[model samples]
Target: MKIGLYFGTFNPVHVGHLIIANHFAEYSDLDKIWMVITPHNPFKKKKTLLDNHHRYQLVLEAVEEYPAIEASTIEFNLPQPNYTSNTLAHLKEKYPQHEFCLIMGEDNLRTLHKWKNYEVILKHHDIYVYPRIADSEDQTQHELLNNERIHIIEAPVVEISSTAIRKAIKAGKNCRPLLPQSVWRYIDEMNFYK
Candidate 1:
């Protein structure tokens, strides 16, 4: 089985996330797109992050309908400031039966050089990059993605972002549109990240 690892904090899962995961699963050669709920990303700030368990649960609620879009918390058991290479290596060892590919945005692709052991990541695994609207500034990166294993997929641009959703929730504004109905209800009921 071929699986695409779609890693993200998913501060609160939304329609945009589901759209991309479904798009990849339905359109790509990948049999399933596991929404890997990254516990921590070295590049991003930790201040705004919700508890890892909450974030993971939100992803599960958002992707519950699609068996191919299940949530994974493998990173939760890894070290802090989780590195992609480390997670990938661990996953490969654990699930040797399944082929693991990467699913990321073009923005991440441009910054891939900064990641720990990026060379290994590029050399060992196949990548499926979805173009982000912001990456339009550098169209060349889309054409000149360094790795031969990389594939640039034209996924629907869902402008929704977790940053915007967090800001809205922090301000006591409604976050209905930015998140799934179940997630929104769960957040409200639990008062998460408040």
Candidate 2:
């Protein structure tokens, strides 16, 4: 199987994430798009993040209707400050028959050099990059952007962010439009981010 691994904290799965995953599943050569729920991202702050299992369950709820999309808790059992390169290596060893591709936003591509063993990741896996509103299209200026393994996908942009959603919920505003119905309902029932 050819899988596109989309790694994120998710915090709470939002519609914007679903849209990107859906686009990859429908348009890309990927057989499935696995939403790898990172319990702790090396580059991000952990204080604001929701519990790993709760976040994973939210992702599972959000993508349940999509056959090609799956929520994965693979990193939960791994070591803290999950590194993409290490996770990729582990996945490759566990599933030798599967070909894995990295799915990320253009913003991440800008800082790829800062990642541990980034050269190995770049050389071994194909990276599918979607444009982010905050990122410039002229990323070709970056030396690593010239790699043939990096593919730029023109998927629809959804400006909604998980941070904004949390803020809206905290302020007693409805953020249903920014998230999947099931996810919003789950948040509402559990009173998350408040």
Candidate 3:
């Protein structure tokens, strides 16, 4: 089976995230897309991250309706400051029957070299990159022309961002549309990340 590993902090899984995952499932050769919930990203600030379990539950709630999309907590059991290579290695050991590929945005592609064992990752697995706001056609050209394992997917361009959503919530603005109804309700009821 071809599985695309979609990793993210998922502070609160939003509609934009669901849309991207759906697009990848629809357009790619992937049979299923797993949303890998990471406790903390090495590149991102640790302070902004939500509790690992909470984030995992949010992803579960957000992707519950999509049969093709499933939420994963593989990172939760892994070491702190989760790295892609380590997670992939563990997953390979556990599920040798399925092939796992990386799913990310063009923005992340630009910083791929900074990731641990990036060369090994690029050589071993297929990478599907969706274009973000900052990463334009030029970035796509660079990625496609430079790597044979890379595929640039044309997903929807939404201005929504997790940082913006968090800010809106802090400013006493409505975050209903930015996130899934379940996620919003959970955040409101629990007063999370405030």
The whole-model lDDT of each prediction reads 0.87, 0.90, 0.87
lDDT of 3: 0.87
lDDT of 2 by residue, 14-110 (tens): 9899999999999999999999999888777889999988999999999999999999998988888889999999999999999999999888888
lDDT of 1 by residue, 47-117 (tens): 77888888888888888889888899999998888999999999999999999999998888877777899
Model 1 bad stretches (over 4 Å): 135-146
Best by lDDT: 2
Each candidate's TM vs. the true structure? 0.93, 0.95, 0.93
RMSD of each: 1.8, 1.4, 1.9
Best by TM-score: 2
Pairs with steric clashes in candidate 3? none
Query: Which segments of model 2 are wrong by more than 4 Å?
Result: 135-141
Q: Residues 58-114, candidate 3, lDDT per residue (tens digit)?
A: 888898889999999999989998999999999999999999999998778877877
Q: For residue 100, what is the lDDT in candidate 1?
A: 93
Ranking by TM-score: 2, 3, 1
